[model samples]
Target: MTEKIAIQTKNISKRYVIGTKNSKPNTLAGEIINFISTPIRNFKKLRSLSNNTTDNTKTIWALQDIDLTINEKEIVGIIGSNGSGKSTLLKILSKITIPTTGEALINGKVGSLLEVGTGFHDELTGRENIFLNGTILGMNKKEVEENLDKIISFSGVSNFIDTPVKRYSNGMRVRLAFAVAAYLEPEILIIDEVLAVGDSSFQKQCLGKMDDVAKSGRTVLFVSHNMESIMTLCTRVIWIDEGKIIKDGDPVSVVNEYLETTNTISETNINLENINKRGGDGSIKFTNLTIMDKNQKEKTQFNIGDTLNLSISLKAIEKGLLNSNLTIKILIKNQNNTTVLSFNNESYNHFIKLDDKNNKIQFSIPKLPLGQGLYSISLEVWVNGGKADTVGDVGVFESTPGDFIGNGIPDQEHSLFHTNSVWS
Candidate 1:
């Protein structure tokens, strides 16, 4: 028998009207008056237009002409930058909002966690909301009873189960909300970036729950900014930009293309006119900073195991040089602003040296642990045990997928550190 398609969309689109107030009249008389004064309004708008015009009354297409299909038991990842419509797509799939046009077909029940505390009532106690959300998802009372204890225990909020949700801390709220959604046993699961709110341990638990759900042959639609999570969990990936699908294929390839196209570095003359210093006792300032590849050319091409060398030039501004130390930090992030690897100044403090002349601070990562995808870097300079200057608006590079002839695992041998792997 042929496998069934779990979800499918034809020309799905969502448009949001921004900067226009609801008080704008919608009657026929109002329309005629606005139409007659269109020319004068146009002239006034042109005169008052500025850089912030994009923020004024304008229409933004969150999702446009998006066509997709997912097979049963498939785990698909949606990757994009902020406002790229990843969450908006999930919201539509969950029936939280209707599409502006087109049709969506879902083959099974869908459980969604779009935002923190979504599908929850602050006035209701944690226990009450569990039943309420489950019922909303079509579960009867007996079914919810069978899973009540398991959900409460999994959330690690047994002590606060009877307390009102509004009184819970932010972390507690996320734990409860995630527990409820994950336990619903829906045939299709849709998750947003809510996993980012919990602590590291809690995040690990959530990843395990998702893995179990996938193992049960259920379809999962996950949206996140963490490339590591996407590579580790997804069977396939889709990249979206400016409300359009740019690439859809294997996770590594799609992520690599998105990173390469977004981050571009050139050899233009260094401009320090608008440099901002980070908070700390000012002992040193970064005079110059540039990223270069192994060939000494300013480029952003890299691979999974490639070596990246960052060259930074700095100078001592104060003469009273005590036991001052120089440090370098490197952060690897995806297009969604999720951080994968963060190396700070303290990690390289042992290699500091005193220099009266222009000093070059060099830090190199022998082999990038990330898989094939796009990653950006954030650099920081420290002096006298405090941050001096930080620069990180446009530092990015691409990691091409390596040759791994084995199973689907990429060059990175380790899974997302969030999983618990043990032999039974």
Candidate 2:
């Protein structure tokens, strides 16, 4: 049995020119002279675009030697850090931009929701734009009308379907755009990170719809930073870093590798303000984190049965938030990126009071139950049922198996977590 190929890219690469700035002259007379010669300099720079003598230092290769073959019915997820060329590759596939030195052959019609309001006319009503998109996808009027009701109902924008698209809010526009891209039935659907603009409930609905599309034997290309969504929805995953394919394989393995590589914090005492790999709306910020023992001494190494304590400091961005309640959570994951233990205040109906009297949280584990291994810590804070801040890999600690089961001899590789039991 042979599977049909839906998209293929051969040596696909994209390049962009980096702008350079001229040094400002200190003297007024020097500035005047430099300003007088600006036109000639601009002319030479403009002319250099068509010449072969371009400075390699002033240009960046957004993609390099990207060879990929995506088959029909496979939902592939592309993940990477910011400026890692994830969006550029999607743009190339959507025909929004062309590669510098390669070709991408697509077998079927592609419906792309790369950005909010993409492929939609601002002046056109939502109803009219639905037909416009269908027409662009080579569908006739009857074909579009057949699915028009489904699209409108699924978008939850039936009330505003007759309104101009420009008048719609960002969330409304995303809902309608996603509904159109999904219900219109393009053979290949490409979605970027625009779903972050919608509400949580809407995002879940979109994920469900994407799953349905995958079951219908259509190809889906999804780009998102949400690792859980990628793991659940994607059949395969592709990790991109610095414009090149880092890993492509099973979703769990690839995502684990990506998270391990991107998590750079490894010390016991960590400053959280500088890390860029965090999420949430930033209404609450994690300022500092420390791993300590019962004596309040900081350390990164602990025995399997030792008492461990985590101290965290948070700051509210707005003064009004100081009076609100906050739900704090911490997750502990092994080196393989599997969460072995998680602590959430809300699970027990306990929440931290955000007031001037208290802004610090301390979580203590009396007897660590984990076997000998390395583990990472992830932090999350929520307010008003929304995520205020989330940071992964905030710190890491090493554990050594030390009589956790009350035996003289400890087995290090017996299991990931230690447990107490009695044989019948």
Candidate 3:
């Protein structure tokens, strides 16, 4: 018997138009005037639409000629950087949005948990939303009634099943959302970053449930920034970069390839001014961020035992901003996107006060203690009781495999670190 194709896309692309500036009116009166002038604007748009020309500044291709096939019962993970169009692909597959050109075929019904409380009514109770979601997934009243208890049990939100979803926290919202989609028995399951809001244990439960779904001969497409979950649950992985598939294959290899190439610090100096790569308040901003070896050599690849230095240059926009409770944090995450190590001034009993507009800070590691794998660096700054900046997977570097200890062979691939052993 030949395996069936679960999904196929041919020359599929999605284009969106975003105005360079706010084109809509800001006030009620202005909106009324704009509504009255809609006829003139429609004429202009109609003439432009007839021609092939458009406002070039307003057009962006989220997906470009994406071609791929997913077989039945296959588990695929999609990985990409921010704005690389991972979510857009999921939306397209889930039928949330139509493509601008080309076509895609899905062989079965789909249940997608794209965001927290997806397809949920804010004023409705959890129990009501569960039924509503089931109906949306094409289940009848009797079918939903039969599976209602199971969904509630799986979500572990039985106590709050009668409570309105507006009162639920982010974690609670996602747990219920995932439970509804998975329990509906959709032949094709899709999830996007649903585990981000859940706690560690909840995330584990969700992963296990999704694994069970795939094992039951159903197709699954998962997208997440948590590399660990993708590596653990996915049989295959696809790395998307700039709205295109750059690499697709095994999980470990694809993830490593994505980390090595994306946001790489290849030069000695990296400019940061006016770069909205991260989210934060405007009280302060980073000017430049640099990574180097102990000898002041610019590189992203390091030996297991080599020293690494991170230099950060920043400036305060407001006067006397640095004299307040401002703290900088550095986090190191492994290939699975799990935080393995973190550093801050409070933990080290070190203090830094902002006395001038321009400031430089350095965090040096005597020896890198990570295993032979790629690790990503995350940075955050908090000032005046609010976050100044928060960035994830911003920079990545590889630690070369080496025998740091006097052993004949290096540690296993599953090892988190290489350390000396005293066996008597």
Candidate 4:
């Protein structure tokens, strides 16, 4: 039997027109002067004038020559840097934006959560928006009412169901939006990075919901920076760079290649610009960061039971008697923002002293329990016992497949944090 493809695209591309500045000016007098000098400018162009065409107008191709096929019941991840055409592809797949050229064919109804609070009316109560979103998904009013309680409970916004969406907090809005989209029972689901906005518990619930949806034989197209999520939820992965697909294959391999190509900081290179910044007040900033193995080489690959070292350098601006503390938060998030391993400074803190000199802080994980995939590192520095600066998703490192030789269970022991591990 031939398996049906849930989503297919061919030669798909998107283009944008950009205007350039004209020093010749828009005023009548300036136009007259420019007209008089047009012949001179033409002569200059003949003599290889600095291609002023780019200064006046240009075109940007957000996506080009994208050919992809997603099989039925498959969960595929689109991983790339910001503006790498991931969201653009999802938008096209979801029919939010038409491709400038070529065609995108989706086999079933798609439920998309492209942006936070999308497909929602601020003036309408949560209860009203649920029905509106369901109708948009091709569901009838009776169907929406039947699932109303389930949606409210999943969204954790039961108390705010009657309240207007305008009164909901940003987190509340995200929960409601995700709930409505996921509960629509669409045959295909397209999600951008909006899942990262919710709280930890909410994110977990969303991941579980997505797992259930995929297991029920629906197709899912997910775009996320969380490598762990990509590895866990996606059966296949596509990496887009500069509006083109660079690699497409197994989730682990694609994620590793993407991180290596994007991150220039080697195991030895500890530079702030290379690492991903998590969260902070932007007072004290990380200037350099490096992660290495026991050999102290610029290591990128780690296996189970391997000791990983993270060294961070920070600089303090306008220094006072700051309560300097360095924290390394290890986050293992799946494509849907499900956190499998989250270790903070309090879990493993290393105090440091900062006095106008560059400070280096190191956190060593003697043995990693995580299976094969990518993990993100977050660094936080506190000044005077308060939150000073934070950097999240700064850099991603790869973890290779390894044995579960440890005696303890995966989640309970930091050395065995598997995304799909079940606790009895």
Task: Please provide, for model 4 over 332-388, each residue's C-alpha lDDT reduced to its tens digit, 9 standing for 90 to 100.
Answer: 443223456666766544455656554666667777766656666655666655565
Measured by lDDT, the strongest candidate is 2
Ten-residue stretch with the least lDDT total in model 2: 17-26
Put down candidate 3 lDDT per residue, 1-424, tens digits, no spaces: 9989999999888776532222566689999999999899777666654344456655667789999899998899999876778899999999988888889999988877686555789899999998887787667888888988898999888999999999998788888887877676788888887676678898778778777887888898999888777888889999987689999999999998877676354454666775544556656667777878898777788877678898887777766777777788989887656788899877787777765754888889887888877777877888866887766665677788755663557545656786666888
Deviating ranges (above 4 Å) for candidate 1 = 20-57, 264-336, 339-424
lDDT of 1 by residue, 1-424 (tens): 8989999999999876443222334689998988888799767556543223434235567889999998999999998766678888988999988887888999998877676555689999999988887777657899889999998998899999999989999888888877877777888988887678799999999888878887899899999877788888899999987678989999999987866666654342244324532323335555665666666566566655556767766666554342366676666776567678888757555656657663776667665556655666666667655666565533567666642333345555543222223578
Worst 10 residues of 4 by lDDT: 48-57
Which of candidates 2 and 3 is the stronger one according to TM-score? 3
Residue 265 displacement (Å), model 4 = 1.8
CA shift at 43, candidate 4, in angstroms? 28
Q: After superposition, how far is residue 27 of candidate 3 from its true place, in Å?
A: 24
Model 4 lDDT, full chain set: 0.72
lDDT (C-alpha) at residue 133 in model 3: 77
Q: Which one is best on TM-score?
A: 3
Question: What TM-score do all the candidates reach, one by one?
Answer: 0.58, 0.62, 0.66, 0.59
RMSD of each: 13.3, 11.0, 7.9, 11.0
Candidate lDDT values, in order:
0.72, 0.83, 0.79, 0.72
TM-score, structure 4 vs. true: 0.59
